[model samples]
Target: MPRDTAYLQIADALRERIRAGEWTAGARLPSRARFAEEYAVGQSVAQRAMELLIIEGFLEGRAGSGTYVRGPRRRMRIPRSRLRRLSGPGGRDNGGGTWQSRSKARTPAPERIAARLAIAPGDPCVVTSYAFLSQGRPVETCESWEPMAVTDRTPVVLPENGPLKGAGVIERMRAIGVTVVSATEIPRPARADQARADLLGISVGDLITEIERTHYAADGRPVETADIMVADRRAEVAYEITFGP
Candidate 1:
């Protein structure tokens, strides 16, 4: 009881300080010893509070360095639509638009994903995962990974229906310097898990579509990989092709 409520209250208080500019971006916060003393809370309580702030995107910590205020949080809004398409190294048609970030727990690169980027498995990669909601209810989730060797700090703000978010993977890769020539997608059918069912508001074992895709650069090097899962009942998957030369 003491630890739970105290930690939340401390986090809430610190959240306000960041919003009020009491701590500016990139400013290092006091050490845990100082925070415990200043907040009149136990060290454990203070530590938990800091953890919460980090998750809430108010602060960041470097291993050898101390915790510091995050630079301004970027604000973005993805569009909502029924149409689906893939873009990037792999022709991953993300089920829908999503928020992308590079935080510790959710880095863009996973081992398999890094392989698609033509880097050693687990090398750093750009990552963004999207949650698709309809009428305020969750319906699907999608995640995409790109190697940092290619992205290299380029701003990746994908807007719903926007070029990067809407166009198929090949085009997006070209914009980033890689020219994606072809893609392979593997589609599979599976039952929803508890988390997927809850998000899509469907029963467990409900039919869902899972797609894993990899895109190859002009040199035949894989440039990106994506995983897309969609709720079958709530959404339909379709594709149309236009002739071009």
Candidate 2:
């Protein structure tokens, strides 16, 4: 078998055994020599398998000590239900977590962001940055952009200010008679850059999930768009769908 294939197979098998409770948390794993002997593979392949697991957050490597099973981290589920997230990121209400947002008004939208909002490039918009906290620790972060054309001069203009402060897209739009009706979220794997790592308190290059989201009004008008990031070790995203007649 190819080196890549061999290492992947070994990693998968080892992951299953670990999940099966063969080694409890903080337990030292067998040496690469032992694993190589058990799998009839080279020690290099065994080491690669161990490294994969370590990068996946399944095991921790100590400088002088051997790799050990990592303790379980909090795993919050992100519901994709339109109802749960209709308003905005962190709208699911899980874990009793709260978020704080800072909005800068009259910011010009960039080309791609303008495209997402269906507006002309450099159009004035309100840019809001959000940090969602759990136990006062940052678990997720988001950057939301709303075209000023849709909300300018309205009570809900600035996302975190005025009468409808922090009410989110759905309610804020509704308060201004915009009638938001649908939202779309596309989630993809990403690497935590320096800025992202600092926000989530993780090391750079860690795996993360980035969701591209947008809210639309009843007339198919794009009202709000955002980029939301969460560390994979911090939470998992789940899509909740309801079938109707």
Candidate 3:
């Protein structure tokens, strides 16, 4: 452990002590001032160290109470299988969680989003956002965008509304005589922003997994695109691929 960074060094020492079961799960920790005194560091440094542990899922904070040891973090597995067809765009996960969604029609697409949909910037689109929770705790979030040129005035216009509600991208498009051929997803590491952190109930600056996904029609036209954000500490993203015969 590098002592140059006082907080991290303190965090390491504290983490080892926690791992040794000195403070069992649900055990209340001493106040920040107490920790600072014991570690011979400033109170702010001790607080930051505790915050790091909280973000790591080893500790939790209570509204009116001090921090306490957290139980083993349960990391849900989120599958990303090429063989599995997506249920439209926003809010798709295999974490056995429920999701709530809100959508808007005729929303204008920004420059980057429009490029993914192969449409001019400001083109009309339907946008949907989803918040996914597992065991009553937030685990993931998604934002989906689809070009109005493809789904406007159609039953699938609103992803979670109408007759084909909750249908997958392929099925929904097929209903309107459009054949979806394939989907592409690009996943990358990201840090939680204030908005995302608040939604996922995680601390800002925490690491997260971001997947950018796009669906395509038979004519090589982009049908839908989405960005999925999963809490890296509470979930694991898995990719399962099999060879074709």
Best by TM-score: 2
For all candidates, the clash counts are 12, 0, 1
Per-residue lDDT tens digits for candidate 2, residues 93-206, read: 656688888889999999999999999999999999998887777778889999999999998898888997877789999888899888888889887777888888876666
TM-scores, in order shown? 0.51, 0.79, 0.74
Q: Which candidate ranks first by lDDT, i.e. highest?
A: 2
Greater-TM-score candidate between 1 and 2 = 2
Model 2 gets an lDDT of 0.84
lDDT (C-alpha) at residue 36 in model 2: 95
Model 2 steric clash pairs: none
- What is candidate 3's lDDT per residue for 89-119, written digit by digit as tens? 4336464778888999889999999999999
Q: Single out the weakest 10-residue window by summed lDDT for candidate 1.
A: 75-84
What does candidate 1 score on TM?
0.51
Model 1 stretches with alpha carbons more than 4 Å out: 1-84, 87-108, 155-168, 241-245
Local error of candidate 2 at 31, Å? 11
- In model 2, how large is the Cα lDDT of residue 158? 89
lDDT of all predictions, in order shown? 0.63, 0.84, 0.83
- Alpha-carbon runs more than 4 Å astray in model 3: 1-17, 22-71, 83-85, 88-95
